[model samples]
Target: MDETEELIALCARALVAQMGDVPGVEMALTRNGVLGLTGAPSPDFNRLTLGAGPQAEDFLISSVGRARARGLPLVVVMSPQAQAALAPVAAGLGLTVAGTSPLMVLRPETPVTPSRPVKITRALGVELVAIAGDLEAAAFDEPRDAIARYFDVCLTETAGVEAWIAWDGDLPISAVTVTPTGDTAGISLMATPPEHQRKGWGRALLTQVMADYRSRGVARFHLGSTEAGLRLYESVGFVTVANLSAWLLPAEGALPGRDRGGPS
Candidate 1:
């Protein structure tokens, strides 16, 4: 793969590793220019697919149709370029497209060093914590041991499997995971408890991860975000680079049977 494609692939794999525990999510290859989105995605989280020829509009319409037919949301996650080419059809479908989380890529040229140094020491007993049991009961609300096991498989099976629950003392507040892809690093499984809002813990965990990536010579760091989380990401130096969106059709929509797809 060329540089761009390679970067996309690295990002995709990192995503897969992060969400691998979410039973509904999976990674599937896409046609040139497109990729699949997997992992318990809402109908709004359809595949970050590529485009076809001049008929790209028609193709998107068809993909949207099939997703809604399965009682699944047809979410199209795409880069800025892909989103631009397919906007006409996307807007017609009541799609909501937003920027990927602003990511501060640690390029040698990326300016503005962090205000303070990050303290990343050991993985054992430390200021970090983790809960490995099935999170569906609380986090996902689906409540099934099997569902929780999904994450276990992903975390244990992968090479870069580290989950963190940052704490000021004994109480748990924020959480984040770091995964690697090629020469870059990916951040996944980020969460902060409701009571922990506005506390700097979330940014602290994220900054710590980014610093680690910098030390490793990672060319880029990647993230996806919702409108609510945009400001938080911006503070760390991420930009408006790509977007993923999809249409929400009623049952028996156009093309029936297209699986929830996009990413790799």
Candidate 2:
């Protein structure tokens, strides 16, 4: 694979690891795709990542079958090229197009310096996990329990993932996660409560995380960006490298919710 392809695959693996350890969740790599099964209400957690190739269509078909068998909503992550190749097959399977997200990367020649002195602390213990989960849920307008599950999974593990919360005078305002894959670190779950937006807390949190990872000898960073935060990430030296599309298959008698905002 080329550098871009390698980076994308690395990011995908990182995400899989982040989703690991959740109760009733399982992940497997097959010739078809990278499959994640979460027999829960969160559709975002149940995903399939498809690569571009002649087998892409077959992979999509099998992935859909796997999701259907589990009776969960299916989110398919595919490169733009792969999406094009499998569009007909996806459509034939009744998969609805769920918007596209840009995959961005940052390769810094020097360690990133924080824009301001933000009191960022590593999230430890169950209490802090609940706080971080609340911050995330408030920021994304999601259910607290759902966001808490993510924190519960990541914080319980030492390898592959790390979580941090930005505090303003002991008041947690933002949260971030870094998952390392090979030489690249994937950033996700970045969220600042609505009351804290436009005040630079998000940037400060991200800067600190970048600096922390850089100190660990990680130079490359990858994230999936939404339109709202694209400019903020660009200000910090991130650039769009590729696009990722998600095709959704909702469970019977259920409608898929709109994609959540912020970096994934």
Candidate 3:
């Protein structure tokens, strides 16, 4: 992989490292570029990402079998480069394409200037993280505790991530997380409640966060975005670098071809 793609993969690795830190979560990093995280509160957390590698097919089968053994719903994620070959393989294993997300990146030289002035705060303690989690859950319409379980891990100082929140007085209004990996930083879990949409709070929060990181001598930032979030990310000078394909198993039971053991 080239430098930009390698940076993207590093961000992903950093993210899974954070997920693995949460109490009982199990993580597997395979030599063939498959990453599995199981036993989290949601299937999204229990994901297996397939990166570009020569033994990807065999690696994927083994990874899925492991998740099956754990009896957890699994979501498989693949980069654009990996999807063309793996999509059919994923289907044969009883998985179907769920959605696609754009991988976006921003270099330090690009300016991120929010249209309005706003105050933002860093989440310090467990209480603040929980509050930020609540805001995130509300924004995404996900179960609060499921999201909080992951957010809480950000409190670990060496986890390479920092959580930030924007408040409306006592109410936590917006939340974002930045994971700094060497010279590049990955932005994730940015949220603002539906009621507060179009108010430019997202812009303000993102700008401030990027500015803070840039001041610290980190220039590059990257993230994956849903279609709904594309415009907002684009407004902040982020451009799409890749489209990641995601697949999910039919249900939480046995995988289709598990009996036909795969090559490790």
Candidate 1 wrong stretches, greater than 4 Å: 1-10, 18-27, 31-41, 44-69, 89-106, 111-152, 157-162, 242-264
Q: What is the TM-score of each candidate against the true structure?
A: 0.64, 0.89, 0.89
Give the distance in Å from residue 5's predicted Cα in candidate 1 to where it truly belongs.
7.4
Leading candidate by lDDT? 2
For candidate 3, what is the lDDT? 0.74
List model 2 lDDT by residue over 114-201, tens digit each: 8988898887788887888888788888777766555566775564777899999979999988888666788988889999999999
lDDT of 1 at 249: 40
Clashing pairs in 3: none
Mark the regions of model 3 whose C-alpha exceeds 4 Å error after superposition. 31-34, 255-264
> Candidate 2: where is the Cα deviation over 4 Å?
253-264
Tens digits of per-residue lDDT for model 1 on 116-181?
Answer: 443433232211222522222243343344334443445553435566555566555566666766
